[model samples]
Target chain A: MPVFPRFTALAESLPPTVPFVGPEAQERTRGARFIARLGANESGFGPAPSVIEAMEQQAGLSWRYGDPENHDLRERLGAHLGLAPDRIVVGEGIDGLLGLIVRLIVEPGTPVVTSLGAYPTFNFHVAGFGGRLVGVPYRDDHEDLDGLLAAVKRENAPLVYLSNPDNPMGTWHSAAAISRFAAALPETTLLVLDEAYSETAPVSALPDIAALADMPNVLRFRTFSKAYGLAGQRIGYVFGNRETVSRFDRVRNHFGVNRLGQVAALAAIEDQAWLSHVIALVVASRDQIGDIVRGHGLKPLPSATNFVAIDCGGDGARARTIMDGLVSRGVFIRMPGVAPLNRCIRVSTGPEVEIDIFEQALVEVMAELNGL
Target chain B: MPVFPRFTALAESLPPTVPFVGPEAQERTRGARFIARLGANESGFGPAPSVIEAMEQQAGLSWRYGDPENHDLRERLGAHLGLAPDRIVVGEGIDGLLGLIVRLIVEPGTPVVTSLGAYPTFNFHVAGFGGRLVGVPYRDDHEDLDGLLAAVKRENAPLVYLSNPDNPMGTWHSAAAISRFAAALPETTLLVLDEAYSETAPVSALPDIAALADMPNVLRFRTFSKAYGLAGQRIGYVFGNRETVSRFDRVRNHFGVNRLGQVAALAAIEDQAWLSHVIALVVASRDQIGDIVRGHGLKPLPSATNFVAIDCGGDGARARTIMDGLVSRGVFIRMPGVAPLNRCIRVSTGPEVEIDIFEQALVEVMAELNGL
Candidate 1:
C-alpha cells in the first residue's frame, strides 16, 4: 500500500526512537515485574489519603470536561506561590507544557540550549520542533549555570533550559547561585527553569517565587508527580509573568488536564502534613541509598532531590552492565544518557520495601558482575 | 517587563482568546453555576459503575506514569476494532490527536480542509500550526462529502477532515457515502475521519473498520468522551494503516495519557452493557429534546449523535436570544459559530433532571423572547 506522503521534511528526517523506555517495557522483555521500581523518580510512597478521597469523589465527575481555564487549581497554586492566578498555566504535565512552550518559540532551526545530561524529554520536545539543540556538559556533576549561560550567549538561543536540584546527577547549587544565573542571562533568552523536583529539595536550594516573578523570560515548571505522588495523573503547571504565561493559552489543549488530577492536586496541596511526611521519607530513602552505594564501593553524589546518583566507579559500559544486571534481578532504576554522567546509576527515593529490594539486588548484581 | 521577544511569527499572529469559552468560564462570568450542562455533548448519564470502580481502585496507584506505548489499551482496542495494535495510537483526546495529525502533515501555508461549522478545536489546531485552512460549508446539516474532496483536489491539500454524525448540527451521512468519499480523496491527501460520536451513531452510519483499514491515508479517530462518559479523562485514539499511525509517535507527548484514564477506558470498553444503556439514554434524551424544540415552535435536526440541534425558525439572532435566555436561566447549551448553522441551538443529551431543566428553561426562554 502507498503510504501518506508530505510529512514535513523535519518529521521525515527524524529517527524512530521509543524514548524513555518505561520499566513496564523492560519488565515485559524480562518476563517478570521488577520487585523495586525506583526509576522515573515517581513517589512510591503514594498520594495522601485526602487526595485519594478527592479522586474517588471526582471519579464520577469525570463525565464533565475539566475547567479549560484550570481556574480553581490555578487559584490555589497562586495562593501557595504568592502570585496571581493569571501568572500560571496548568497543563497535562511538565512534558506537555514544555512542548507547548517550545512550539510558541521554536520554528525550524531555532537554537535551544540545555545541559548535556538534562531531561531528555525537554530535548525531545526541542528536536520535535526542529530546534537546533546546543548542549553544555555538566560541571562537577551539577547543571553548570555558567556553562549554560555562556552557551545561551554564544548561541543567542531564545530558549534555554535549567533544572535546578537537577536529575540524573542528583546534584544542586544554592538558590543564590541560581538567581544570579537567571539575572545574568540576556533578556532575549527565555530560561525554562524546570523545578519538577523542587518539592523534595532543601528550602535553601529553591529560589523564592518573588525572585523570578518579575522576569517575563523566566518560567518555572512544577509538578504533582514528585512529592505529592501524582505522576500517573499527568498534572503540572508553569508560572511566570502573566503576559508570558498567557501564551500557552494560544496553543495548549484547553481541556487536556485530567479532572481527577485537578482534584487530587488540590487535596494534596491542602494536605501539608502529607507533603512534609513524604519529604522526610524521601530524605531517609536517599540516605539509605547512599549507604548501599558506599557499601558497594561506589560514590553517591549528595542530592537535594528525591534521588541519588551513584558513581559506579567505572565507565559508561560498566554502569550499563550493572543497570542491566539489576533489571534482570527484578530491580528497576535508571541512569543518565550521555557519557561521564552515564558512569552513575540513578536511584529514586521510595518506600522501604522498594529500597530493601534495591539494596538486596545491588549486592547480588555486584557479586554476579565481580564473580564473572 | 519586556516579554520573551522571539515567539515565532505565527505564534505572535495568533489571538489571545481562551478559544473554547467552556461552561465553567460562562458560570464565572454570570456569577453563578449552570443548573444544567448540555453544551459540550458530555454524557450527563456519566460513566458506568464498573468504569468508575476501576478509576477508584487505580486512584491510589496515581504515582506511576501511564505506559508511553499505551500498550494494553491499544491491544484491547485492536481486538475491538479488528486492527493490529500497531495501527492504533492513544492520546490525551481526539482534540490532542487531531493536533498531532495536523502537525505531522501541515507546514506553514499548508492547505487543510474541514467543514466551516465543524469542530472549532480542529480549526484552532490548524491555525496554531500555521496551516491555511480551507473550509467547505456544511451541505444541509451533514458535512458535505463532495465539497471536502473538491477542496482537497483544488488546493492539493495534504490534510482534510470530516466528522460524520456531525456536531453543532446532529446529522449524519450513510456509511456507504462516507466510504465513497474516502475512496474518492487523492491518496496524497490524508483524510481524518472523526468518529467521536460513532457509538451513538447507528451502525449504518459507520463504515466497517476493515473497509477503510487498508487505506494508508485514511485515519479514523474515536473517543471515550461522548459515549463512554470519560470526557474529562482525555483518552482518545487514532487508527489507520500502521505506517501512517506510526508518525504520531514522532511528535506526541508519549506520556500524556493519564494512568486512571487508561484504566477507565479499559473498563469502559469492557462494559459494553453500559454502553448499550447510555446509547438508549442518549436516544431517549434526543427525543425529549426534539419534543422540547417542537414545543418552542422550532425544528430539531435529525440526529445521529448524543445531542439535538434545533433550528430556531429565524435567523442567528433568534437562536442567540434563546441561547442567552437559557444561559440566564442557568441552562447551559451551545450553538454553532458560523452562519446558517448558527440558526440552531445545540443541546446535548443528559440525565432526566438536566433534560427537565432544559425543557423548563426553553419554555421560559421562548415566552420571554415572544413577549419582548
Candidate 2:
C-alpha cells in the first residue's frame, strides 16, 4: 500500500539516511564485536563511580517523569558555569538541543553557514528544516573563521555552527580568537558554539563565561558525553543571554530529558575530582595514540581533545581502506567524511588496554595494506 | 539587549508557555512537599525490581551511546507484538515522537483534528509546527468519534488524534467501535492512535494488532511510562505500516534515547509478571478512590484506565476550588482544563498509603469548605 501522502514537501524531499552509523550497528553488520571501541569519541573511561551509584540509588524512582522544567539540573549547571539558571537550557544532548535551536530559527531556503565537513548531525538538522547550508572549506586544517564570516555576511545567513577543540581533526583555536570571531558576526546571525570537548581541551582553548555571556546571538553548547563520560546518558545544555536562550522553551519537549540522566548529570557535575582525573587519563591516552601511530610511520595531528587524528599519508580512499581493514581486524575507529581531513583516521582516547588493541590492529592493517 | 532578530515568524509567534506545569514545579511554588503524589498519572508503585536491577547493572556502561537504531529493544518489541521490527520506531518518549510525526506532516496552516479536552502535548506540537487545530468537543465525557470523523471530513485534516482508555475522564471505546472509526477515516488522514494506558485498560478495550496493522495511515503509540512504570526513562514506541514509520528516521535524533533507559525498558518488558502486579494494584486503588469520592456525595466516572475523574455536581469553579483545597491540604490532584470536563477533578491510582492520604485530605477539605 502507498504510504500517507500528506507529509510536507520538505519532508518528502528529505533522505532517510542518518548522520552516523554507530559502532553497535557495525558490530551487527560484521557479526563480531570489536576488541577496542575507539570510534564515536565516547570515553571508555566511563562515568564517575559516584554518578553510577547515584543512578543506581534512584533506579526505583524511574516511574516519576523527569521534572519538565529541569529545575534542579539547570540550577546546578548555572552555578557550575557562573551564569543564572535562566541562561541555561538542558536537553537530550547537544544533538537534540541543536535540532530545537535550528527549528526556532530556520525556515525553508534560509541560509545557514558552517565549516565544510563539520558535525554532520547539525547539517542533518539544517536539511531537515529546509535550510540551505553554506559550507566554508577548512584553511590549513582549521575552520576558516574569515571564510565562515564572509559566507554569513554574503548569504545573510541567520545561523552558523562551530565546534572548538574540534572533532575528527582534533584542531582548535585560542579563546581570544574565538571571541573576536563571535564579535565580528552580525547580531542577526545566531552562532552555535559547540564545546562538546571543552572539558578535555587546554585551559587556553576555552572562553571565560563572562566573555560571551551577554551575546544574545550566541548559544554555547556543552555535553557530559566527552570528558565526563556520560554519552549514554545524553545530557547536554546550552547557555547564553536569558532572552535568547529562552527561545528554546518555545519549541522544546519540556520533559524530553530522561529522569535518571538528570540525576546522573547532577552527580557528574558535583564530582569535579573525577572530571580532573579523567582529563589526565585522556591526555595520557592521546599521547599514547600519537606515539603508536608515529611508530607506524603516520603523522599524528596536534590535539586538544581526547582523540588524535592520524594522517594515513594518503587520500580519503586510502584512509577508508585502512579504517575498514582495522575494523575487520577487531578495531573500531573512524575518519573524517570529507577530503583533506579525511586523509586521517580518528581514534578516541580510552583505557590503555583498548589503546593497546588499537595499536596491534593498526600494525597489522597497515602492513596488509602496504603489501597490497 | 534584544534577542536574535531572525527567528522564523511562526517561532516568534509561539507562546513560551508549556503544556503542563509539573508537580515538582508546584512544590517549588508552594514551598512544601506533597503528602500524596497522585497527579500526572505516573505509577506510584514504581518500575519492576528486575528493571531497576538491570538499570543499575548497566549504569557503568553509560559512557557508550545507545544503539542509534534501538535494535535490541525494537527486536524484542516486534516479537512481543507479532509485528516486523521495521514497523516499529522507538523514540525519546511519546511526546518526542509526537513532535517528530507532527513535524513530518504539519506544515503551516495544515489542519489537524482532536477532541477539545485531549492530550495537550499533542496540541502543543501541532501549534509548534504551525498546524491549525480543530477541536471536537467530547460527547458525554468520552471522545466523540462521530464528531471527530465529521470534523476530519469537513477540514480535510491530514491528521487526527485519539487516545483510548482516555485521559482525564478515564473512559474508553470498545475495539469494534475504534476499528470502525479508523475504517471511516479518509485514507489521507493519518491517525495518531495513542495507547499509553493500554496495559491498564481492559482486554475488550484494545483492538487486536491485525485489525488495523495493514492500514498505511494508522500509527499506534505505546509507552513504558504507564503500566510498566518507566516514565522517567522516557521510552515510547510507535508501530504501523513500515513505510509510514520509516519516515521518523528522516528527522529523529538517533542517540536521543539514554542507554540505561533502553536497558530498563527491555527488562521491564521481560518481567511481565510485574506489569500484571501493577495493573492489579491500580485497579484496587481506583476502587478505593471511587469509594472515597462516593462517600462524600461526589460521582466517580467509570474507569478502564488507572485514574478516576470525579464529578463535583457543580461547575468548573466548584471543581477548581476543591482541587485547590486538596492541594493546600497536601494532596496533589489535577482537573481537566476545558469546561464540561473541568467540572471533574482527576486523581491517578497509586499505592494505598498515598491513596489513604488523598482520602483523608479530601474528607477534611470537603468538611471545611461546606462549613465555609
Candidate 3:
C-alpha cells in the first residue's frame, strides 16, 4: 500500500524505532511473562491504599474529563513546595512534558545538551523536534555537570537536560553542585531538571524547590511514578518561574492529564506515611541487591534512587551476556544502551520476592556464563 | 520577571489565553461548583461496571508503566475495527493524539483547515505548532462539508479536521456524504476524521470501516470517552494506513497513555453489552432533551451524538444570555463560539437527575430572559 505523503520532512527523516523495548514486547517474543518484573525502575511496592481508594471513588466520575487547569493538584503541590500554583504545570508524565518543552524551544538545528547515556526519552523528544543534541559523557559514574555546562555554552544551546539522582547509573550529584551548574548556564539556555526519581533520593540530592523557583530558565520535573508507585497513571508536574511555566499553557494538552491520575496523585501526596514506608522498603531492597552483587563478585555502585547499577567487571559485551543470561533465567532487568555505562546492569528495588528471584537468577546466570 | 530567554520566537509570540475556559475554572472563580455538570459533553452514564471493576483491580499494579507499545489495546482495537494492529496507535486521549498528528505534519506557515467553530483543541494544537488556520464557517447548523473541501484545496492545506457526529452542534453528515468527502480530498491533504462521538451516532451515519480504510491520507480518530464512559481515563485510539499510523511513534510520548486506561479500554471493548445499553440510554436522553427544549419553544437539532444542540431562535448574544443565565442558576451547558452556530446551545446526555436539573434550570432561565 502506498503510504501517506504528507509527513513533515523532519518526521519522514526520523527512524522507525524506539529507545526502550518494553518488557511486554519482549514477553510477546519470549511467549512467557517475566518471573521478576524489576526492569523499568517502577515501584513494585505500588501506591498507597488511600490512592487506590481515591481512584476507585473517582472511577465512577470518569464520565467527566479531568479539570483542564488541574487546579486542586497544583494548589496542593504549590503548598507542599512553598511555591505558587502558577509556577507549576502538571502534565501526562515527565516524558510528555519533555516533548512539550522540546517543541516549544527546539526548531531544526537548535542545540540541546545532556549526558551521553542519560534518559533516552529526553533525547528522543529532542530528535523528534529537530533539536541538535550535544552529549557530555559521564565522569566517575555521574553526569559530568561541568562538561554539560561547557557544552551548553559552546553550542549556545537553548535547552539542556540534567537528571539529578540520574538513571541507568544509579548515581546523583550533590544539591550544591547541581545548583552551581544551574547558575553557570547562560540565561539563553533553558535547563530541564528531570527529578523523576526525586522521591527515592536522599534529601541532600535534591535542591530546595525555592532555589530554582526564581530562575526563568530552569524547570524542575517530578513524577508520581517512582517512590509513589503511580507510574501507570502518567502524572508528572514541572515547576519554575511563573513566566516560563505559564508558557506551557500555550502548548500543553489542556485536558491531557487523566482524571484518575489527578485524584491518585492528590491522595498520594496526602499519604506521606505510605511514601515514607516505600522509601524504607526501597532502601532495604537496594542494600539487599548490593549485598548479592558483592557476594557474586560483581561491583555494585552506590545508589541514591530506586535502582542500583552494578559494574560487571567487564565491558558492554560481558554485561550483555549477564543480562541475557538473567532474562533467560526469568529475570527482566535493563542496562544502559551506550558504552562505558553499558558495562553495568541496572536493577530496580522491588519486593523481597522479586529481589530473591533476582538473587537466585543472578547466581545461576553467573555460573552458567562462567561455564560457557 | 523576564521569561526564559530561549523560548522560540513563535512560542514567545503565541497568546497566553486559551480557547475553552473549563467549567472547573469558572467554579473556582465563583467559589462554587455547578449543580448540573452538563457543560463538558461528558457521559454522565459513567463507564461500564466492568471497566470500573477492571480499573479497581489494576490499581495496585500501578507500579508498572503503561505499555509503551500499547500492545493489547491496539491489538483489540485492530480486531474491533478490522484493521491490522499496525494501523492503530493509542495515546493519552484524542487531545494528546491530535497534538502528535499536528506536530508530524504542521510546521510554521502550514495551512490547516477546519470548521470555524469546530473542536478548539485541534485548533490549539495547530496554533501551538505555528500552523496557519483557515476556518470554513458552518452552514445551517452543520459543518459545511463542501466549504471545508474547498478550503482544503484552496489553501493547499496539509491537514483538515472533520468531526463526523460533530461537537457543539451534535449534527452529523450521512455515511455516503462523508465517504464522498473523503474520496474527494486530494491525497496530499491528510484528513483527521474525528469520530470521538461515533459510538453514539446511528450506524447509518457512520461510513463502513473498510470503505475508507484504503485511503492512506484519511485517518479516523475514535475514543472510549463517549459511550463507553471512560472519559476520565483519557484513552483514545486512531487508525488508518499502517505506514501513516506508524509515524505517530516518531514523535508521540511512548508511555503517555495511562495504565488503567488500557485496562479500562480493553474491558470497555469487551463489554459490548454495556455499550449497547449506554447507546439506548443516550438515545432516550437525547429525546428527553429535545422534548424539554421543544416544550420551551426552542428548536433542537436532530442529533446523532450523545448531546443535543438546541437552537434558541436568536443570535449569539441571546444564546449567550440564556447560557449565562443557566450557568448562574447552577446549570452548566455550552454553546459554539462562532456566528450562526453560536445561536444555539449544546447539552450532553446524562442520567435523569442531571437532565432534570438542566430541564428545570433552562425553563426558569428562559422565562427570566423573556422577562416573564
Candidate 4:
C-alpha cells in the first residue's frame, strides 16, 4: 500500500536513521551479550548510592507526572551554579534538548556550523530539522573552534555547536580559548556549548558561570548522565541569558522531563561527595585504560572526559577490526566515526571489575586482529 | 538585553507560554500544596505493586541508557496486541510521540484538524511546527467525529487528532462509529486515535486491534500513563502499519525513554489483575464524583474515562469560580479551556481517601462560591 502521502518535504527527504547503534542492538545482531560494556560513554560506575535510595523511595510515585516545571531540581541547579532558575531549562536529555534548540533556530535550508565529527547526535538533530550542516574538520584532534567561527561568519549561520573536553577524540581546549570563541561569534549566532563532560574535566577547562552567563546566544548544556552516573535517567539541562533560555518554554514538551529523573538529579546534586569520589575513580580508570591500550601497541590520547580515545596504529580499518574482535569476545567498545579521529577507539570509565575485563579482552583481541 | 537575535521567525512569533499550568506550578504560585491531587488526570491510585517492585529492583541499573530500540517492551506489547514488533514505537510519553507525528507531517502552513479544546499539548506542537490548526467544535461534549472528518476533507488536512474516551468532558463514541470515521477519511489524512483511557473504557468503546491496524493512515496512541497508572514513567506507544510506525524511528530520541520506566511498564503490563483492580476503583470513583456534583445541583457528564466533567449549571465564569474555590481550598481540579466545554470542571479518579477529600472539598467550595 502507498504510505500516508503528505509527510513534510523535509521529513520525507530524511532517511530512517538513528544517531547511534546501541550495544543491545549489537548483541541481538551478533547473538551474544558483551560482558564488558564500555561503549556509548555511559558512566559504568553507576549512580550514587543516595540517588538509588531516592529512586527506590519514590518508585511508587510513578503514578504522578513529574513536576512540569521541574521546579525543585532547577532551583537547586540554579543555586548551585549561582544563577537564577529562569536561566536554566531541564529536559529529557541533552539529545532531546538539542533537538528543541535546533527546531527553534533551524528552518529548512538554514545554515548551521559544527566540527566534522564532534557529536553526531547534534548533527542528527540539525539534519532532522532540514538545516544545512557545514562541518569543519577537527584540527589537531580537537574541535576546530576558529574554523567553526569562520564558517558561521561566512554562512551567517544562526547556529553552531562545540563541545569542550570534547567527545570521540576525548581532547579539550582551555576555558580561555572557548570564552574567546564565544566572544568572536556574532550575537546573531547561537552557540551550543555542550559540557556533558564538564564534571570530569580539569578545573581550568570549564569557564566560570559568570563568564558567558549573560551572553544571549550561548547555551551551555550539562548532563547528570556523565560523571554523575545517571545516563539511564535521561536528565540534562541548559542555561544562558534568561530571555534566551525562555525561548525553550515556547516549544518544549512541558511535562516531557521524567519524574524519577528529577528525583535522581536532586539526589545526585546533593551527593556531591559521591561525585567527587567518582571523579577520582574516573581519573585512575583513564590511566589504567591508557596503560592497557599502550601495552597493546596503541597510543592513548590525553583525555579530559571519562573515555580515552586511543590511536590504533593504522586507521579506521584497524580500529574497526580491533573493535569487531573485542565485540566477538564479549567486549563492547566504540570508535570515532570519521577520518583522523577514526584511527582511535574510545573506552568509557567504569568500576575496576569491568575495566579489568576490558583489559583482558583487549590483549586477546589485539593479538587476534593485529596478528601479534 | 535583546533576546537571542536569530531565532526563526516562527519561533520569535510564538508566545513563551506553556499549554497547561501544572498543579505543581499552581502550588508554587498559591503557596500551598493541594491536599487532593486530582488536577492533571494522573492516577493517584498509583501503579501496580509489582510495577513498583520492578522499578526498585532495577533502580540501580538506571546508570545505563534504556535500550534504544525499546526492544523488550515492544516485543511484549506486540505479543499482547497480536502484532509484529515493528508496528510499535515506544516514546517518552504520548505527549512526546504527538510532537514527533506532528513534526513529520505538519510543516509551516500545513493544515491540521483537531476538536476545539482537545489536547492542548498536541496543538502546542502543531503551532511549534508552524502548522495551521483547524478545530472543529465538540457536539454535546463528545468530540464531533463527523465534523472532524469533514474538516479534514475541507482543509485537506494531513493530520487530525481524536482522544477516545475523550478528555475534559470524558465522553466517548461507539467503536463502530469511530471505525467508520477512520474509514471515511481520505487515506491521506493520518488519524491520531489516542486511546489513553482504553483500559478503563468498555469493550464496546474500543475498536479491535485488527480493525485499524492495517490502515497506514491510522495510528493508535496508548499509554501506561492513564489506566496502567505509570504517568510519571513517561512511557507511551503508537502502533499502526509498519511503514508508518517506522517513520517515528527516524525522528525519535532513540535513547530518550528512561530505563526504570521500561521496567515499570513491563511489570505493569504483566500485572493485568492490578489493572482490573484500578479500573474497578475508577468506576466507583467516577460514580462518587458524579454523586457529589449532582448533590450540589451540578450535572456530571457520563464518562467512559477515569475522570468526570461536572457542569456547574452556568457559564465558564461560574465554573471558573467553582474551580478556583476548590483549588484555593486545596482541592485540585481543572476545567475545560474553551467556551461551551468550559462550563464543566474535570476531576480525575483516585484512591478513596483522595475521593473523600474531593467530595468534602466540593461541598465546601460550592457553598463558599454559590451560597448553597
Top candidate, metric lDDT: 2
- Model 4 chain A — which ten-residue stretch has the worst lDDT? A363-372
Worst 10 residues of 2 chain B by lDDT: B363-372
Superposed on all Cα atoms, model 3 deviates from the true structure by an RMSD in Å of 1.0
**Would you list the C-alpha lDDT of every candidate in the order shown?**
0.91, 0.94, 0.91, 0.92
Candidate 3's error at B141, in angstroms? 1.4
**Ranked candidates, highest DockQ first:** 2, 4, 3, 1
Most accurate candidate by DockQ: 2
Candidate 3 per-residue lDDT over residues A1-372, each given as its tens digit: 888888899999999778788999999989999999989999999899899988887787887888999999999999999999999999998988998899889999999999999999999998988888899999999999889988988999989999989998989999999899999998999999999889888899999988989998999999998999999999999999998899899999898999999999999999999999999999999999999999989999999999999999999999999999888877999999988999999999999999999999998988987895
Per-residue CA lDDT of model 1 for B1-372, tens digit only, reads: 677788899999898765579999899999999999999999999999999999999999999999888889999999999999999999999999999999998888999999998999999999998999899988887788999988899999999999988987888999999999999998889889999999999999999999999898899999999999999999999998988999999999999999999999999999999999999999999998888788878999999999999999888999999999999999999999998899999999999999999899888888888895
Q: For candidate 2, report its TM-score.
A: 0.99
Docking model 4 quality class: high
TM-score of each: 0.99, 0.99, 0.99, 0.99
Q: Predict model 2's lDDT versus the native.
A: 0.94
DockQ category of candidate 1: high
Residue A159 in candidate 4, Cα distance off native in Å: 1.1
Report the lDDT tens digits of candidate 4 across residue range A151-249. Answer: 999999999999998998889999999999999999999999999999999989999999999999999999999999899999999999999999999
Candidate 2 per-residue lDDT, tens place, A162-260, comes to: 999887689999999999999999999999999999998888999999999999999999999999999999999999999999999989999899999
lDDT of 3 by residue, B1-372 (tens): 887787888998799878689889989887888998888878888899998888889888887898999999999988988888998999878988998999999999999999999999999999988999999999887899999999999999989999999987888999999999999999899999999999888888899999988788998999988899988889888988778888998888888889999999999999999999999999999999999999988999999888899899999999999899889988888998988898998888899999999988988998898799
Query: Worst 10-residue stretch by lDDT in candidate 4 chain B?
Result: B363-372
DockQ of 3: 0.87
lDDT of 2 at B228: 92
Cα lDDT tens digits, model 4, B130-218, are 99999999999999998999999999999999999898789999999999999999988999999989998999999999999999999
Clashes of each: 1, 0, 0, 0
Quote the lDDT for B110 in model 3. Answer: 98
